[model samples]
Target: MPEYSEKVMEHFKSPKNVGEIAGADGVGEVGNPVCGDMMKFTIKVKDDRLEDVKFLTFGCGAAIAVSSMVAEMAKGMTLDEAMKLTNKDVAKALDGLPGNKMHCSNLGADALHKAIEDYRQKQAS
Candidate 1:
């Protein structure tokens, strides 16, 4: 197993925003079959900002920590701001992820971006 940073372990042990948002404005789901990791992010928006963010992730400690960190970062961010969020940022927020588990950060960012996309699509309709 790869060594994890203290922040990663802390988030994995007690992830914030761990559940789904009821009647969420947007939801995104992604999976990496090669790594058997799955993630779903749900969000609520208000005035073009992410009013709330939550996630349910099934994967290793790194993936869970990534999801938790993503949720913490995206909440209250403007849609444009959240859209710019990147895997690099997530990994940095967690201090860093081992090279092999870095993909977890990618998944987290993708999931949040997709959720924002979903919300935008709804608005456009």
Candidate 2:
């Protein structure tokens, strides 16, 4: 049993913001090949706020759903607020994910944080 809800299946089947950004301020890619899950997240930030987010994920239904939800949640949020987003937040936004799929949410949060960090580093330079 995949433990996926209808919403999760819907998102997975038709993910939103499923592409790369042109001139993205930051891009982060993470994956566990052993698990066959990979996600690439691109972000554009302006005035310390997330102007946009997009993702391309190669994984299971849970991974796609998490990635889509992460992108939707991160956009229009300040960097500080986006950084505060945790796996729990993503899971909660999706109405809770399966225990085994928890790592998918973790991947989304980690990639978003990494992208934000990358943006900060570029701005510092």
Candidate 3:
């Protein structure tokens, strides 16, 4: 049986940053067709700082937990700092995830990085 951390369960039940930003500075979508996990993250940045982060995910419980945690971690961070976010950090934030769910952690980090990259592209254009 997979034992889920209490923190992960809590975050999933009452997810943070669950909505969408009307005019997001960046938006990123990623999915693993093999596992059928999909997540879309949107960020609003101001003064190079991550003002807000939101996500919509279609996956298992682990995916929801990871997405919620990522949103909470990204807010108030600078774009560079947010970019540095890793799957390990997210797993730690959740008090640790099951070994089988490790990919969910990676998915969250990838989505956030993609969103940051989108923001950078917008700035460049």
Candidate 4:
């Protein structure tokens, strides 16, 4: 088993922002075939800021914890600021993840980025 940090366990056990936003401004979904982890992030943007963020994750504890961390980190951030978020930042925030599970953080960041991209795309149309 992976040696999980206390923070990771805590978030996994009681993940925050764990639902969907109705009529969300944007939605992003991603999955890893190897680990069979899937994540979906929904965001509400107001005045170019992430007014709210939420996620629905179907995966292991690490993935769930990453999703929660990403949501918390991105909330209230400007679209540009949220876009700058990276997987490494998520891992570091959690105090680190097992090497094998590091990709979970990537999924979290990617999901959030996709959501932002989706919002931008809508604006362009």
Candidate 5:
């Protein structure tokens, strides 16, 4: 296995926003069967902004670390700002992820985006 960055290890050992938001404005769940890595992201919106964000993840250390990082990145941002977040941004926030585990970590951002989309769809209908 590849060695992880110090930041990655730090987040993995003590992930933040590591649970669901009760009555979340939006919730998204995603998984990679091949890697057996799964993630769920929940969000609360206020005035078109992400007032809060949280996540639950199962898999490797990288997955947990990325989930934490994504939540930190999304919180307190406008929906448009949060939507601009990308996998690369997630990885960079974690100080970078192991090459072999990049794909697993990438799911964090995808899950968050999905939750935001879910929230938007609900608002439209």
Candidate 6:
């Protein structure tokens, strides 16, 4: 097994914002079929800011950790700011992820960005 960071373990053990938001302003889901890792992110935006964020993830410890960390980081951020959040930033916030599992960080950010895009699309329509 990979030696995960303490922060990773912490997030996995007790992930924050773990559920979905009913009637959420936006929602996005992504998965790696080969790896069987999946994530769903939901958001509530207000005044051009992400007032709330949540996620449901199924994967390894790293995936769960990334999901939790991303929600926390994106909350209260403007839509543009959240969109700029990269996988590197998510990994750094968790104190870094094992190289073999770095892709989990990518999934986390991708899911969030997709959700943000969904929100924007809905607003524009």
* C-alpha local distance difference test of each model: 0.95, 0.92, 0.92, 0.96, 0.90, 0.95
* Residue lDDT tens for model 5, 33-104: 566799999999999999999998888888889999999889999999988999998888788888888997
For residues 1-125, write the lDDT of model 6, one tens digit per residue: 89999999999999999999999999999996577789999999999999999999989999999999999999999999999999999999999998989988999999999999999999999
Model 1: per-residue lDDT, tens digit, 36-99? 7999999999999999999999999999999999999999999999999999999999999999
Candidate 4, run of 10 with poorest lDDT: 31-40
Model 5, residue 112: distance off in Å is 0.2
- RMSD values for the candidates in order, in angstroms, are 0.9, 1.0, 1.1, 1.0, 1.1, 0.8
Q: How many backbone clashes are present in model 6?
A: 0
* Candidate 6 segments whose C-alpha is farther than 4 A from its true place: none
Off by over 4 Å in 3: 32-34
Higher-lDDT candidate among 2 and 3?
A: 3
TM-score of each: 0.97, 0.95, 0.96, 0.97, 0.95, 0.97
Q: Give per-residue lDDT, candidate 4, residue 3.
A: 96
Clashes of 3: 0
**lDDT tens string, model 3, 1-125?**
47899999999889889988999999999996578799999999999999999999998889999999999999999989999999999999999999988999999989999999998998999
Better of 2 and 5 by lDDT: 2
lDDT of 2 by residue, 1-125 (tens): 58788878878888898999999999988997787899999999989899999998999889999999999999999999999999999998888898888989999999989999988899899
Candidate 4 structure quality by residue, lDDT tens digits, 1-125 = 78999999999999999999999999999996566799999999999999999999999999999999999999999999999999999999999999999988999999999999999999999
lDDT of 3 at 63: 93
lDDT comparing candidate 4 with the true structure: 0.96
- Clash totals for all models, in order? 0, 0, 0, 0, 0, 0
Output the number of the lDDT-best candidate: 4
Question: In candidate 5, where is summed lDDT lowest over 10 consecutive residues?
Answer: 27-36
